[model samples]
Target: MAMFVHLTSAANAPRIRRSGIRAVGHGQGGARGVYCFPVLPSYTHTHQWLRELARFGSRGGLVAVHMRLDDTQEVLVGRYSDRARGAQSIVSASEAVRRIAALEDPRGWEVFVPRAIRPREVHRVRTAPQVAGWRYLPDAHGVRPCTCDGCRVRGGYGSRRLRERLPHPLDGPPPPVKVLLARVEAGDPGDPVALREALHWFGMRRRGPLSRLSRLAHHPDPGVREALVWAVGRWSTPGVAELLDGLAGDPDPDVREAVEVVRDPE
Candidate 1:
């Protein structure tokens, strides 16, 4: 058997003790599953989700519901954003533990069992530290934080303070695709940071003029070319293939690597 821990609100303790943790969706468009982490040898690593989970405003208190599952039980495992990016993979319970343990930094990794966990499988429900893990993201300290609405919750903990402390180029709602494209088309493309932000926003939103974006393949700045690769990958329209093929052999290794990561899975 493999040990795992599910962090939840202490308010649900009674029902969880009686009927077990229910399989339900969390977050917008989240998959229905019981999220947990493999109870590794390191106590801190096992309970790394405590602080981040508490940010959701749990009532009563927070607790860690330790549970056990057979090594053969299958589950979904990947980075925290893998599900949203359509990149999560399936593996056995033991394999999931081994895979995460092998990572140098498994802070954002998670496992999802698709069904309900019976009360029998729950080892114990114990009080957990309210502050044990990274909030917002793992190791976010020292990095320039994004203040975009999508990235920062309007009233989330310390969100306003962080935005005031670190203003980013991509800090507000992004301009429309045409507006961004116009900025790139200007003879003097100002602010490389803003330019890159525009391209990345295009990629994320999956909009804009595909033909015009394709022309950026030969942009002078490698960073622009890399951002172009991001935008181009989001487009599945005509002419995108030719642009990607050209970018696959970019002189800069980073641009080529971006092409690999952004390319649609086969």
Candidate 2:
């Protein structure tokens, strides 16, 4: 009765369940459930489907993925869309698998535990980042940290649409840019996870304001600062080199090193 959306190559869903992997895969995906839908997950309309799996008639929904390798991999399961940008397809399933695997190999993807849903829900769909409680961490060593790629392609084509020059990543009936910006501006300095997510949203924006980057450049946490550098590089903006040049003097060695690598990629 659940929908098992398999985003990666192969993982032997039965083995995953027999071992009692505990709702680790996205939407409990990859399992050859009573009902399963195999589709390559993307940041586009995929997010809407993830939330309303039951609406799609699956008892629950799951998107099993791995970060990069197709070897023996684990995937980003049920994980919710980005709080700020919703969900965009950026990081590949394998990319996420490798990142999580790094934290706790094989069971690395277990880090993202989604809300449990039953088969008979008649109304209301669900999404991730429940305002508070637990959160997903985007590792420092990630290529495109989050798996949402739709936004990475600049919402549609180019970075952003000219008519809709909004701060938030392109979303239907989008939230006010100010509100999205506030999430970053007012994020907890001590929580690198929160700050990095904010920086990520800004970088993902096609028409995002550049000031957001500078404002968070000297964030209290070095990890957040490092994230800021990554966001800049990821966004591929106009004066990226100039901006990174300024960050050369950043106090954190990691931040400076990131600038160097991003400035001249091999």
Candidate 3:
């Protein structure tokens, strides 16, 4: 019993006048009903619709308008129009989504507003004081006493400065994959090195060589899948688009919602 109407130019003004009156009666008759009206694609058209709706005085009516914006930044507003009443303008789509998640209705509708796009300008800044000259520490052996807390704790002033040889080539233990997985999952913003390493290992190109490891991205474990989604957004790799497209159809709504966030224009 729900009805949807698309409005555009002033040329359709007469048609809206006829339809708006009918929608109120129609909505009141149905147990649960919606009257969706999408506007044509132009800012001028959208503005006109708002003006007309206000003029019609359909303030308490159940009629809703839809606004469409094109890539060129044109806005189109559509609605059922009745001279007897004006329609309420709903909240924007982004706000509506949040309200919906909170189990609340965002009863009004507004047109999409395109934000101004500007190019980023990079300016170099000095590195943090903590690691500013850290590279020189390894070669400070004998030349300077080790002031490191570790050296003091062990009661050995410069023991850490003494260079140690690498373990025998074949004697070193391989890295623990589970630990690596856990580190990636943690995704602590404080640890850029760990984040980068995890991204490299699980990413499409590098992961291609590690087929079994990459399969963990689509693992049955919710934690693993969630981490994979986060990694994909963090990395923002080219192939990630295809992966997200696939996830858009996932049976799990959470996964689909995550994918939608990355795909959204805003």
List residue ranges in candidate 1 displaced over 4 A: 26-30, 148-266
Top-down lDDT ranking:
1, 2, 3
Cα distance off (Å), candidate 1, residue 124: 0.5
Please state every model's RMSD to the true fold in angstroms: 12.9, 17.1, 23.4
Q: Candidate 2, which segments miss by more than 4 Å at Cα? A: 1-147, 150-176, 187-191, 234-239
List TM-scores for all candidates, in order: 0.58, 0.35, 0.25
Q: Of the pair 1 and 3, which is ahead by TM-score?
A: 1
Most TM-score-accurate candidate: 1
Superposition error at 108 for model 3 (Å) = 24
Q: Model 1, 146-232: lDDT tens per residue?
A: 776456654577866777676556654456777888877766545567777778767645345777666667777899889888766
lDDT of 3 by residue, 1-53 (tens): 11123222343334344442111122221211223322223333222233323
What does candidate 2 score on TM? 0.35
Per-model lDDT: 0.77, 0.42, 0.35
